[model samples]
Target chain A: MMEQVRVVLDHAGDISPISSEEYLRIGGYQGLKKALEATETIIDTIKASGLRGRGGAGFPTGLKLSFTANTQADQKYIVCNADEGEPGTHKDRIIMVEIPHRLFEGMAIAAVAVGASQGYIYLRAEYPYVATILEQALADARRQGLIGSNIMGSGVDFDIQLFIGAGSYVCGEETALLDSMEGKRGEPRFKPPFPGVQGLWGRPTIINNVETLSNLPAIMVKGPKWFRSMGTERCPGTKLFTLCGNIAHPGVYEFPVGTTIRTLFEEVGGGCPRGKKLMAVQTGGASGNIIPASLLDTPMDIDACAEAGATFGAGDLMFMDEDSCLLDVLENLTEFFEEESCGKCTPCREGNTQLLRLIREFRNGTAQEGDLNLLLELSNVMRGGCLCGLGQSSPNPILSVLRFYPDLFVENSYRKGDLAYA
Target chain B: MTTREEQLCVLEEVAAIAAKWRDRPDMLIPVLHEVQTIAGNCIPKEVAMTVAREMRIPLAQIYSAATFYSFFSLEKRGKVLIRLCRTAPCHVKGTKETLSAFEQALGIKAGETTPDGLFTLEICECIGACDVSPAALVDDTVYGHLTPDKVRELVASLQETEGSR
Candidate 1:
């Protein structure tokens, strides 16, 4: 296996996250300087790097920039999606805390590439501490002439400010984030007039994930070929996986894109606390599908994981042992989705509650075998009929369990006594 | 209970905050955040009305936006807000036991505040501290690797801090 690659986490522990001087000393703004020298070719360099978004959706970063650049507008905006609410995903928090200036620099480069003048970091409210660190980092950069009017004397004016989410998980969706920034009930808008065409006060906008933007500076400095050489051909460069749950070690680790479930779990995660036997592994967070031990050899590539009935979303790898009951876990996840569904659409608002009720009945030992079919039908409806990603992906956990551990649902259905599992 | 004069003062404060973003009508969330923070963790009805009037938006819109978010509580919260992680990662690591310990120490359940109004225990999604499973947030400070005893000790420390004040 490849050694732990630090492409995304290069400056995490070496220097204080808020220290502008420390970040600059380690060649922090080199990429932004390079981009400033030749602003027009920056998009081409990014396109050549083959960097997809580090967010759950692996869209090409260069293609997104080109759309906004091509659009004609009196004003435009660049939004950094820092609302990392996906359960089991915390790598963005690590990036925001350890190397915040990297994010600022990346945003600056993106502004220059897309010809945008202003930017915003849409931070999640849960991370108030990280917000302060980021605010301090922005203050330090502004003081040093790294941000604000005519940065680095490159004659390009760009400014960025932080906007906090109001405890809405749906706000992590790009349009929903835009709505939340506009001070409305965080709900997703219709597509086609996508954010690239009309966003953030009806101006052309480009929304990039925090980790995705964090890569821009480095990709510029090391060159695209150097980045392409690190990971698999399809998904280039190292991906940060937040490894946690029922393991010997639980923290964020950066691994190559094609690392197998076995290596990520057994080798790096220390293999499911002693003698427990890794029963299951959940990837991509609550919205991601499951990878049973039978499929432990499946690669973490997006297409490969999709073929295995799972998604490589945000690289949230969670391990579970024999002692943990999948039924209880499903109930916990279902309840979370129901509470966070935003109630804008019928499918997500109603379907999530129905799913939670069904799972609770099963856990209470009063469920009928027919309820399983009902649960399946409802999940399909939500997946197809929901308006946004939150509703569409909310049923992923149940569907993954149904795909992998069918017997767990079968054995629990219509059972009488001795249902004392927690 | 706050006096009529105090309520009017809060409305004035809300109006003042709303004036900064009146031209930028899209800045509704930040404006409510400031009002809630100033109004002791809950968005008072009077303050919401002032914000709506100043922003030229409907009161219903303000209420809908405020109540839509879990972070913006419509009811009054205690001095310290305790957000416990209830995600699967923390659940498997014995979060139920830790939660029970907190419930016992606080003399109330997870969604309720203590009788003295010093603490409010809430079950939240992962706060991104899964590395230390059974992690919790006490007013923005994260405490991880918690045990039942540790929870009691934490409550005692908070109680002591409150007593000295």
Candidate 2:
């Protein structure tokens, strides 16, 4: 049995999330104090910790911070990507609602490292209640001198404001998030000049995920070597996996990055409910690839999952029992991309529309023999041509289904008398 | 339909919200949120124009921002908007039946509002409550683990509260 190893969720249930004193009692903001004392080494220490972004893309945190730190700007900014819009992922919400001070302290550490004075928490519109909790936490932090000007008499003036995102899934994309923060339509900006160099009103900005930032205090308090002791050498630290769908224990579980899918399913999730057999699992969120039950031993790390032709996006594990239809699942996933395409680029807008049509044909038992190839061909086009990550990864579900369960398409389409076009 | 005076009152309320945010172009979404609240759950044309004029932004830009997000509705919605989760996690956990239950209880489909302006039924992509599959957002609060009986009871309670009010 693989028990949870809580690192980011260190003070989740024990502390009052709104109280800064409770957080302080448990040694919160000590990381910021340490970072302040040795400001120059903060970035280097983070780099050595081997922490990566927890917002789907596993970009190295220290590398991202260095980009903004190196850039010469009059006023740089730090933005926390709290827009937890991934379909099955709510780990960031848990971190924000449970241990908001940890997130604030983390942001303050980053702000001090990068010489940034302003910070923004781009919270999603759906979690309005969570926003209130964060708002109170921010006020308490401000009152306690944890945030605001001259934090702990360190002469580092830093403050954070919460910006509520109107409901757009694409806004979860960092560039789109910056555009939305500037009060424009939440369309993703072209990246050549990434947000690290020119972002949020053409100023150098660093946007870190809520979970990634939440890990900073722990990493700062415990040295880099201690941080790297638990997880794999390349991908260090624990991940909060949001387990849901067909499982007995469907909630957030904190485990090391290299944990296997089988341990997650059988030991942690207690297997499928009502003694049903697990047929398939979709790691990551809606945009992640689906893996068949046969490959249950694949380790849940960034490099390992990539080697297994999957992504450990935001660490979401959505299980499916034998009774579930993969075709029906594909249709739901396709429709999501279709509705959320944003229409800024032709490949994503038109590609998702046509992809949904093709998937629907298979679902309705009217798919032609050549339609499957057409689906794969279009997915490749979108993957290569789309402007942002949303469009680029929209076809992940279809591609994975084609890779693992190509027989599902054939079986669903060959139903007797239902094949109108055949 | 609102009278001209009532529309003016809504415009006045929207102007205050715009001013509160300093009429900055970057504060358009926040301003629109307040405008939508005052305009009875939708940003009607006059309210949009009021915001555009107050914020000194192009009406086209305001409309683009409003239409881009699913949260901001251009059309009027019910007093209690029920946004059901339509993602795969919820779908596999029987959200289709939960959706049907909501439709049956409200006497309307997914995109319609009750005749009395009491409730609006809509399907949203995800609210990240998959742990409690078959989840829904009744206004801003989330209700999870829904069933047909639960849906009926929730609708009845909502209607009863509105009746008492």
Residue A297 displacement (Å), model 2? 1.1
State the local distance difference test value for candidate 1: 0.88
Candidate 1 regions exceeding 4 Å error are A1-3, A417-422
Per-residue CA lDDT of candidate 1, range A1-422, in tens?
A: 33688988896888998888999999999999999999999999999999999999999999999999999999999999999988888999999999999999999999999899999999999999999999999999988888898898888899889999878889999999999888788999989798998999899999999999999999999999999997778888889988888888888888888788888887888887876898888888888887688888988877788988878999888888988788898998888899889888999999999999988888777776478789899999999999999989888999899888777776775355533332
Best candidate, TM-score: 2
lDDT of 1 by residue, B40-159 (tens): 788878788888888888889899899999888888888789999998889889899999999999899998988777799999887878888889999989999999999999989989
Q: After superposition, how far is residue B11 of candidate 2 from its true place, in Å?
A: 1.1
TM-score of 2: 0.98
How far is each candidate from the true structure, as Cα RMSD in Å? 2.4, 1.4
Clashing pairs in 1: A182-B26, A183-B29
